[model samples]
Target: MRKRLSVSKWAITVLSILSLAFFFTLGPASKASATINYGEEVAATAETLIGSPYKYGGTSPRGFDASGLTQYVYKDAATNMKIPRTSAAQYKIGKAVKQNELKFGDLVFYATGAKGKVSFVAIYNGNGTFVGATSKGVKKVKMSDKYWKERYIGAKRVIK
Candidate 1:
């Protein structure tokens, strides 16, 4: 009886240790196997347009509006995806993504005017930073800023 009890405890201990090891190992392996993100390509292309001028309906290298910039970048990345021209329309089309889950190439939207509607859009560059066109032109700004935090409406994922 004593020998049986000792063996049972050892088995339980071994099983617990193995379970813990398996749990820890599984996470990294799954993450490593994650599919390639096209957003990374879009983001890299967007970063190159940081200094471009902001033109209301511009969609080219010469200048870009908020949604225009996003449209250009994704298209430039050769994803061949179609995107809307206005910020509000763009917001309505993509998969809803929470602010906390924003990733590279994700569309971040804002309510900028007295009417407080979704009127502006930006491409998230990760690490709390996003690039957009404002009166100030194409620039990178942080969501933590007082102005932006208050205006932030939502985010959307355009890729898959």
Candidate 2:
């Protein structure tokens, strides 16, 4: 005959299993929540600039450049810190991260032009693409676009 486990032992074993599951699931859920919020903020900011013309050195609704767009989005959504207003300057302001490590609110930079002289910036939307205002206006573009993929410099996390 087999002996049954003691009540206390069974309770402890069950509790431990439940605790482990809770802890494991908690981390991923929290991360997902944060991502959702970040995505919403990014989409809202992008929507606000739907028709704003892209102007070099511009910083407001009057117009915006790549970095200006990033600054405005972060400023409006973050409300706690100010970001730099130029692509190169903004690139220097955040914690450097890899392309695959990008999260919502992270800045993605690219070198445009044959000599890689012009820099463009965008906000990662937690999807496969990023959002930014350009001469065509605010829109989402694939991170893997031929030009973007070729010019991809790196990414930076400014929110944390």
Candidate 3:
């Protein structure tokens, strides 16, 4: 009877120690894995559409216009947040972010036609590049290019 009682206590002690070890090992890892970076997710989703054709008012994988691409990406990547269908309207929805303070999923607007007007929008890809649907097609371009640089209007932060 004494031997059996000691063995039972030993088993309980081993089980408690194993349970604590498992909890400590997996607690933070599970949390880290669950965290979702919405901005990075948007940027990644936009990148997958490179080479997609550009359409005047297109809004799908088939083809996309400047604003259409932005809209589609936001809808597909961040279902919780919705953006307007046009560049001008989109520029209105998000909090204004300065060019120097831009982030991964920020919407960078441009005045391709008239100065001070938001005519085009692109997803800022960090460094100095942005992805957008241009006349040629969906592609990444340098924000420092003479044309883009001069036409830069402002940027908006849609992902918080």
Candidate 4:
């Protein structure tokens, strides 16, 4: 009986080591990870605030303006990253990309303010659509629309 018990213990140890080795080779079957795609993450975060009220200088779920929305989204979505607080400042940090080259999470600017300046900003969600906060509230708008097209200044990609 002792011999049999000893054999069983040895078998159990071997099986445990083998299981660990297998896990090491093929990776864990149910491991939690944090492989974040920052752009998609930012877009997803913005999508959750679809109907949030547009508040002047607001930056939280309670309310959000154009720059406030961008600032909050990037701060929440990306790790260890801080963005500019205003539309013009945000545009200045990112690399200038042509409108056609704009991709998901790219900041689309418009000359909505006086003097045709980059005063408005939106997050481009690809296929010529973008999400932003307007005077009405947070809503998705098409870049090809007459008003947006007329005001369209350019786009900038802040994500690496």
Candidate 5:
């Protein structure tokens, strides 16, 4: 019985080695590149609300505040990504991104009210532009704008 068991173990080991060898012959697996650009999709979704009214604590089509617009855009894009409701909380998540390296859909934060305190957020529209819900409602603003440039706190990448 011992001898029979040993033979069975030997057969199993041989089969495992053969299977590994066969897998290796196929070479290193290639990573599939994502065809869907999530950042772009998110930016597009934000654009749909360009003319939306500004509601201090709003988070829907009727109106939106700074953070509300960002959260709604991400949710609407169907990325399954959820962000914090307030700009300060949203700023706490995601990797820090440099202003020069900003990409589409990256969240750009600002200290609209006080020094070193995040109070507003916007979605980078690439090429130095961003969209957010301001006093005048949802609109695209340039990063080079004097007001925004002065209030610029930093940026974060929420999308992978």
Candidate 6:
């Protein structure tokens, strides 16, 4: 009787695993809705910082530096996932993605000094632009802006 019970339990576990695999592989509606929701959340959070002042090491509505901006944006949009508070620190986290593979909400890094130190991070908004805080304030800038272009290090996608 004990052996029979053990076999039944094994069968139940296997069936449960198979069911989950089928649901994830075949759930089209669920997958699409999740993607749309993520895009909207990222866009909304970015828009909220349209006029925030640039404050080095700041992380709130009152002000934000480059890394602070990235942290705030992701915190608000990414369902509470904690990201590093500085650009260099953020660079050390997340999977490294190629420049050509960058997607919206991805973290783009820029090198600061001659030694290629990561100095800044911006949210890649697609269409060749990114949103970030600069001396002027939070605003959208061209990906090709000379300073950024020269300093471009890489990108990271933390949301996925």
Report the Cα lDDT for candidate 2: 0.76
The sequence of per-residue lDDT tens digits that candidate 4 reaches over residues 32-151 is 576877777777777888899999998998989998988888888764469889999998988899987877888899988776799999888778988898888888889999999999
- The 0-to-1 C-alpha lDDT of every candidate, in the order given, reads 0.84, 0.76, 0.90, 0.85, 0.92, 0.82
Which RMSD values do the candidates have, in order? 11.0, 9.6, 4.9, 3.8, 10.5, 11.5
For this target, which candidate reaches the highest lDDT against the unseen true structure? 5
Residue-wise C-alpha lDDT for candidate 2, range 1-160, written one tens digit per residue: 9999667878989999998889887866556543336545765676667678877778787788778888887777744458876788888877998777777777888888545654889888776688877767667888988978888888887765
Considering TM-score, which of the candidate structures 4 and 6 is the better prediction for this target?
4
At residue 146, candidate 6 shows an lDDT of 92
Q: Candidate 4 overall Cα lDDT vs. reference? A: 0.85
Model 4 worst lDDT window (10 residues): 1-10
Best by TM-score: 3
Please give, for residues 75-108, the per-residue lDDT of candidate 1 as tens digits.
7775667798889899898799988788898889
Task: Give TM-scores for every candidate, taking all chains together and pairing residue i with residue i.
Answer: 0.74, 0.68, 0.80, 0.78, 0.78, 0.73
What residue runs in model 2 are displaced by over 4 Å at the alpha carbon? Answer: 1-40, 114-118
Candidate 4 wrongly placed segments (more than 4 Å): 1-35
Query: Candidate 6 at 111: error in angstroms?
Result: 1.5
Output the worst ten-in-a-row residue range by lDDT, candidate 6.
31-40
Which lDDT value does model 4 have at 15? 97
lDDT sort, best first: 5, 3, 4, 1, 6, 2
- The TM-score that candidate 5 achieves is 0.78
